[model samples]
Target: MLRISQYSSVSSQQSEQQYVPLKHVSVETFIKFFAADVTIKQVFRNDETKPIEAVYCFPIEEQAAIYSFIARIDDRELIAQLKEKNETQREYSDALEQGHGAYLLEQDEKSQDNFIINVGALPAGKECHISISYVSELDLVENGSRIRFVVPTTIAPRYNPNTGDVSSPAGTTSKYVQTAPYTIEFRCQLEPLKWLEKHPPRKGRVRQIFLLTDGEISNVNEVLDLCRSMATSTRIFSFGLGHSPSRSLVKGLARATNGCFVFIPPNTSVDIHVGEQLQKALQSYISGIQVDWNLGTTVMSTPTRIPPVYANDRLIVYALANDP
Candidate 1:
């Protein structure tokens, strides 16, 4: 996913600003055994009348390790190298002062799952091409029988407190203009090994499901009962989006399956919560969990059956006492 904006002074009016537009995007992934390698390429163009700076924000998997980053402008190609943040910022500023094109990339201050790139001094009608590559371990799902890989292609809007409204800082659209159409290409390759063939995956066995919905369902009780029946075989993580989602249905499904639920308010980003859930899903879990209470014989718990406990995850238990 990509979010792009134009760099301008704070004094500039919103109607006078123009943003860089995305031209093309390409993605390729290779999977071998339990690991995956991914590469992404994106092109941007400046169609404004004057030279402008471009800012792009993108997200990556929390467990991924980026190994390569390169930028190409016309006949020149530059490779990124790790350096001190302050030193790199100083150098980038100096390049812009000297009337030279500069590119700077850094992780976002507030979130480690996102990155920001600055392209300075791009003249009108010019183009910039960026390519990035990274590797990550595939997550095990379906009771450790299958692997799952995901690529996020969108970022939710955020609420701004000062303006009392929703806003997107990295948006490509301005108040008076909208971005042009862009093209995307994607491909994936998988290689099977001898060991994988020996232990083939079982069909029709879904161990986990992440459900995100923004609307209400009419058959809430039926869905809850279905999830409860599959509790021993499957775990369901539910997310309710926007203000219109039915909280009772969303929470009931997760409770029945002994999973987790998240409520995303209107105009809020789901990246942080989604990342946290993904990490928990990938960790080792302790099954057949049992809780013993020493308070008294009158003590009773809401959930008589304990759910599977994951490593490094918090667990909450609710209990009620007839006598205090």
Candidate 2:
């Protein structure tokens, strides 16, 4: 945390403007095969001579399960617990009105991914740190060994045509970008496939091609053609980034190779988004899975519906046994 202390006393005639209390924010993420964990730390300081409050708005994954929130005011630490939305709001309001250092965390009803954090009543030259933690499942690529992970840094604006309720959740929308100063796009060349062809899949091995894109591509057919040729030898998993990436190209590539595609929306926290997409993709897998059981000589097994299962995935089986 950084503090600003250099300031000259203002003249009585000069009017003083409000100072922005937010200093900076830092985020860290850790990801594994099946899950992603994130920690966010925000620093707020009051540089002015009077007490003030600071409010920070941010976004997280819609599916994220936040388990911990801690507020540090110098040496004193306050851990926030889960409560009803209304209860949490009231408590935070009361604390702030009473001039106590209060920290509040709440999710937006309109969008689960959006969040508002309030730190109330910091005395002059004082600072506070807010820490948040959450966990979400990681998404599995079409291939068993490889997975996809993302951490969103920004939440792009969304358009709302209806005017009934104009208010939106925090971090939900912002000024839209009509034309970026410049645009850069990347595509797969498939030149690597030739190298892989020389060394074909042997034994029980699997080949995978993972694609991640943030924008639309003009040459969807060409990419599909290459995927079609390599379908027998490879599986391609695709991810569409941002609000409206090219669905045709993403799905077509995956479909051509008998793989899967997942669309990532804007305003999604990157790591959480990656984890959620991977988890969703893994859930779609229903092929090449089996369940086995061993029973006594006098026992018999009943039939049951077995959903598609895949390798390295979890399956729960329920069966009825009777005497033979």
> Which parts of model 2 are misplaced by more than 4 Å?
1-22, 142-145, 161-240, 243-324
CA-lDDT, candidates in order: 0.62, 0.58
TM-scores, all candidates, are: 0.51, 0.50
Question: Which candidate leads in lDDT?
Answer: 1
Global fold similarity of model 1 (TM-score): 0.51
Question: Against the correct fold, how does model 2 do in TM-score?
Answer: 0.50
Q: Per-residue alpha-carbon lDDT of model 2 for 1-324, expressed as tens digits?
A: 121221212212222324353577888889875678989888877877765445455667645779899999879999998888777767765665566666778865434455667666667888888899998656554434566665544433322223242211121111112224455444445466556656668767667656787534444455567667766777766777876454456656666776666766667666654564455455546754445556663433322433334455434444555643
Q: Give the Å shift of residue 119 in candidate 2.
A: 1.1
Tens digits of lDDT, candidate 1, 87-174 = 8877876776666778888865433445667787777788999998988766554335567775644333321122322122322223
lDDT of 2: 0.58
Candidate 1 lDDT trough over 10 residues, lowest sum:
184-193
